[model samples]
Target: MTESLATTVRVEMVRGRARFIELRAGTFLSPRPLNVEGPFARLALVGRYATLLAGDDLRVEIDVGSGVRLELVEPSGTVAYDAQGGSASWSASVRVGVGAQLIWRAAPFVITAGADIRRHTRIELADGARALLSETIVLGRAYEDGGGPLRATMQVYSNTMPLLVEDLDLRNTAHRDLPGIIGRNRTLASVLLVGARPAKACGEHETLLAGAGALARALAPHAHEAQAAVDASWERWSELVEGRAV
Candidate 1:
């Protein structure tokens, strides 16, 4: 069966202020509003229970109405435990209306040894809409080799036109050890900014996407080391997405 626990969060502009139109808690995530002001809202995704167990299916949905801005934060990261013979899944779908914006700085997702999990993200953006998203993936915890096998995928669309499609497979250590692949790195961090392009490249890790955005990614032995470059890109790209930078 599919996941029965689907958390949803929706925001819209009302009376010249951004307001929560819908906030539903799922089995895993609870959406709680932290602050709201003119055209902007801040929310925290609080975990209600331990997650990423065998046969666990977790899903999240988000919507931002036209001209509104929503920022989502997580209190902690997630770890996928060994599934034995079963597998787990985590998926999210996002929609940004015309001129709207979404900023999500997701926490790390760790895959422990013997864990098999799949993570997917889909984003649809209307004209003039923008989004800034960050992600960190850890193969295994400290003093461990890595997880069994994990697949991460992402797809982004500008209305009906596709903007980005990516897939990362770490099912085999030999393939993952390829030079161009992750090599010996245990952590991977990425930052994506859509609907606007950065004025300059952050460094060798930055790449301007085929669409109207850019992506910054890095690999390191630890999450903190990989996050530095991605965070630097976030600083510049987030400002442009929010119209704070030129």
Candidate 2:
């Protein structure tokens, strides 16, 4: 007789203009090959979620399973400068991206949340030339009022410096209801941004997100337009917070 094992895998990346995130459980990513065998059931899995804000300019891929395969591809943009006898001027605009993926499974249930951010800008001119961007998201059926006990998070990244990464593992839904984690909230969310946004803009963004109350309400009766709202929320949190990366 042999004892079988399960595995979980996660791969994430953040850079100049592209990002990719992926994860899968039931197969716990481990040194030993992940193989789970049960008398009545057997489980196997793999997948990924990627976002390319720059179409035709950036590409990324994630092949997830008991084994994880993560990749990112980005086509750089340009910055030009010119001189006109007495004065010189320069202007540039670059678009970046932020992405994430969460894999949830039951029977021992596994929950994972992944995310990434990438963007850049250049300007050689005026006194108050400015730009801004951000991302945020709250996941749950706040409207229909649904809740769950499942929780987990996995994220990874690398750049010129040491590299930023976050692996958040949440457990005990009842615990999350404590005084800190989520307080009395039943929503899960993340936000990212670029440049700077006015206080009014920030306030408005949050107000708009009030509609994500129900996962079903999040969905557009006409079509699945909730993605737009979800995306908006995620970007709002993109705002940089002073803290150590986890």
Candidate 3:
């Protein structure tokens, strides 16, 4: 896809309130304004056209200025259809200014049989900035055996220091199905908090990273069930993000 095809959303603090400074529509996704609450401005991601087809490339860019709070939501889940021997990709890059906050309640992403996908996210947080993010990946639709290959990667940094970095390759069924790995699970859900420390861990899947962040991950037979596993951690961590003193 051309560089102009990338969607961009930018928000900044204006007169003690968060305001959208830029909104650019892309070939795949468009940013729509929602209501605002206090210092937070809400935005919904709307699909401009059908997506996840073979050879499709989707990109989203987000920027939040200092002292601004932004919340992003999706109307519905995303599904990747059969690629017919081809592949598709989705990537997002985010930057949060000093003392800013970002909360993204992303919908589940489904991979259907014969689909191949590559997903990635990179977040850059300034000092005292915080972010709460949730992601759910469904292997297949109802009553399906399994979905196609998927390679997922995530990187988060605070200033110039790395907070978290991970890469997962679910493309190989044999390796992915191993006991320590996914193992019979069709859904994987995760909640990640960065740039601040929570009081305590809430669940068995929750882990405090070396830096100032926490991650809660779950694998289950269904998408809804998988999300339930990290609900508590999400709540606590989001509260910390919302009430950040910075």
Number of the predicted model whose TM-score against the real structure is largest: 1
Question: Taking the tens digit of each residue's C-alpha lDDT, what string does model 3 give over 114-218?
Answer: 899999999999988999999999998897877899999999999978899899888986676777888889999999999888767765899989989999999
Model 1 agreement with the true structure over 1-246: per-residue lDDT tens digits = 245679999899988899899999988889999999899999999988887888888899999999999999999999898888888999999999999999999999999987899999999999999999999999998978776688889999997688999998887755887888888899999999998887677679999987788999999999999998677898888899999997
Tens-digit per-residue lDDT, 11-87, candidate 2: 32323221223232321121212332221112233212122111111111222221211121112211111111111
lDDT of each: 0.90, 0.24, 0.89
Ranking by TM-score: 1, 3, 2
Quote the RMSD, in angstroms, for model 1: 1.2
What does the lDDT come to for candidate 3?
0.89
lDDT of 2: 0.24
When sorted by lDDT, best at the front, the candidate numbers are 1, 3, 2
Flag regions of model 3 displaced more than 4 Å: 1-4, 244-246
Off-target runs (Cα >4 Å) in candidate 1 are none
